[model samples]
Target: MTEIIKAESLSFDTLLEETSFTVESGSTSIVVTGKEEVDACLVRLLLGFIRPASGRLFMFDTDISTFTDRELSAVRQRIGLIYASGGLVSNLKVWENVVLPLAYSNKFSREQIEQMGLAVLNRLGYSGKLMALPGHIPLFQKRLAGLARTMLMDPDLVIYESPLTGLNYNERNQFLRIAREFHLEKPGRTSLFLSSTPEIVPLLEDARVITFTQRQSS
Candidate 1:
């Protein structure tokens, strides 16, 4: 498998200094922070939302920091992100939501996009909501919709931001099972990067944990 994403000595400073350990492709790694807050800077840094102060970030061997918007869009087209809040377009129906990425890339035929969306939704037990607007569905189902959207494109990498958040134990377990199944089915084709609170560590031992410690003032 190719090295899809890599980061070296990623760091940021606002009120405090925050650093992330280097990460490479085909490897499952987690970032845990001592602070209660999620480090949006680190997350954005890795996702190419922002540039690092002085470090290298590569996607498919291309330096992401130097990529033009069009170039970055091409790279992002190959990556799927399941945001912390289930980044669904509230007005869009489930099917529409699933096809959003394909629409952006202009790579899928109408038939192909529909088939892909339905296949993922069916696998996630969400077939009934194909025409339902996102706001109408329950929170868990909305999250499932987000996952479906991410999975529909079958991208090389999927970055999930707190996928199990706001779920009860049973829901979390169900999501994990589905995620594991998805990973196994794809084998080496798709890699996953998950971010969550430290509390989830025990549940996800299969992942490499990188705890983020806040740097103190000199």
Candidate 2:
């Protein structure tokens, strides 16, 4: 298994420290900090959305700290982000949001985007109204739609930010099952879940977990 993400003594603005770890290809990594701000910083650091004040981070073997603005944007294309709220547009219908990126790219015809979106949503077991707004659907279905949207892009890496924040036990189990199955579908695919609690440790299986309880600065 090749290393997909590597962090060496990674620290962020006195918010996080001792973040050294490696996530191998085709594996899952759970980072638990039990602090909302630190967890957000970790997500930003991992996604290249922000840089660390100290230490190093490498994604797909590229030094994130060294990447230029344009280079960082390019790297983000290979990554997918799932938020606790499903990160859908409230004004857009579920179907429209499912292919929002494709629509923004204008790379495909309207019919083409619709076909792809509907197909992926169906595959994800989203049986809600395709034309309904996000607020009109169940929370789980909203997330399923978000997952479908991410899958349509076929990203090499997936970052989940508080994915199970509002979910119940059964929903979390089902979502985990779906996420694990999706990760296995692609060789060398890697997934990272950021959480603000250690409680999630028991909910996972066969995952590499890194916990930071102290905020130390040098």
Candidate 3:
């Protein structure tokens, strides 16, 4: 099996325990860490947002710790991150936030990205106003908006952080369905969900579950 993500003895500032696991390509994995800190820290580490205190992290067979800034950016562009809080820039409109990353990359013209942003959001069943600021929208819309941004990137690996936390059954099911179908769209697509809820295990079909509890400090 091709390994998409591998962590060897990875730990960070006592927030997370020494953890090592491999997520193979085209597989789904759920990492349920009861502690919010540990869950967030682990996601950040995997996304290369923060450095691990010790050990190593490898993404797509490249050691992220050893990568230069330019190399790391290239790697990250291939990964999508869906935050629990929608991860929008508060000051920007929903449309702007949705297209922010793509706009920054400068891969497409402004008009092209603007069209793609709204198109994906609508395709994902988001009917909210694109002109509205993030704080003005409901949680479900916020979640969808963030997901729409991810879809624009067409990432090979998608990392979800507490995707079902505050949503109702219908909303949760819709989100899960969209995410699941997205992962299945490509044979080599991989997904990793970091959540604190044990109930999520059943929601993720065929996912390899890994339960993590933070260690007590001495």
Candidate 4:
């Protein structure tokens, strides 16, 4: 099995340290009860946005710390991020947000992109919100649209940062279902949930778990 992420003694500021772990391909992992700064720093480190303060961070056997911005950009395309804020362009409609990355790469024509966007939204249990402007849609649908965008690319690894942060009980269950279905439907697509809520951890069945409390020394 492929190793998607491996970190050893990772530290960033006072938020993280001695955080050693490995995530294999097609597996789900969670880091529970993480501080906000810890979550942000971990994502930054994984995405190669910032260098780690100490220790190593590797993505698919490549030491991300050694990569230049250009080198890292290649790897970034294979990693998908579901952001806490949904991260959709406010000016774009829901469908537009879903297809923006595809459009940028010229991987599909305008008509093809539209169909692909609609198809992904449908698969994620959404319909009829595609034409709605981002500001016009509810926050839940906006987040779903963001998820559709990420899924359209069929990325190798998907990272969910506080995925259940603002959701109510039912909404949280729905989101978890979608995430589980997405993971199970594909082969070799890994997932990492970085959340501060310990309650959300056990919900992801069979997931390897690590906690910020375990990484920090008293």
Among the numbered candidates, top TM-score falls to: 3
Once fitted onto the true fold, the runs of candidate 4 whose alpha carbons sit more than 4 angstroms away are 127-136, 214-218
For residues 110-207, could you state the per-residue lDDT of candidate 4 as single tens digits? 88887888788877777546777888877678778889889888888999888888788887898888888888878888999988888887788788
lDDT of 3 by residue, 148-199 (tens): 9998888999999888888999999899999998998887899999888888
Q: What digit string (tens of lDDT, one per residue) describes model 1 on residues 17-90? A: 53535444555556665442354454576567877676677777888878988988777777777766678897
| Worst-scoring 10-residue span by lDDT in model 4 | 209-218
What are the runs in model 2 whose C-alpha is more than 4 Å off?
105-107, 135-138, 215-218
Q: 25 in model 1: Cα distance from truth in Å? A: 2.3
* Residue-level lDDT tens digits of model 2 in 114-211: 78887777777777888999998988888888888888878889988887777888888878887888888888888888888677777777788987
| Candidate 3 residue spans exceeding 4 A from truth | 105-111, 213-218
Q: Which pairs of residues clash in candidate 4, taking residues 3 or more apart in a chain or in different chains?
A: none
Model 1 worst lDDT run, 10 consecutive residues: 15-24
How much is the lDDT of residue 186 in candidate 3?
Answer: 81
User: Mind sharing the TM-score for model 3?
Assistant: 0.92
Question: Is 3 or 4 the stronger prediction by TM-score?
Answer: 3
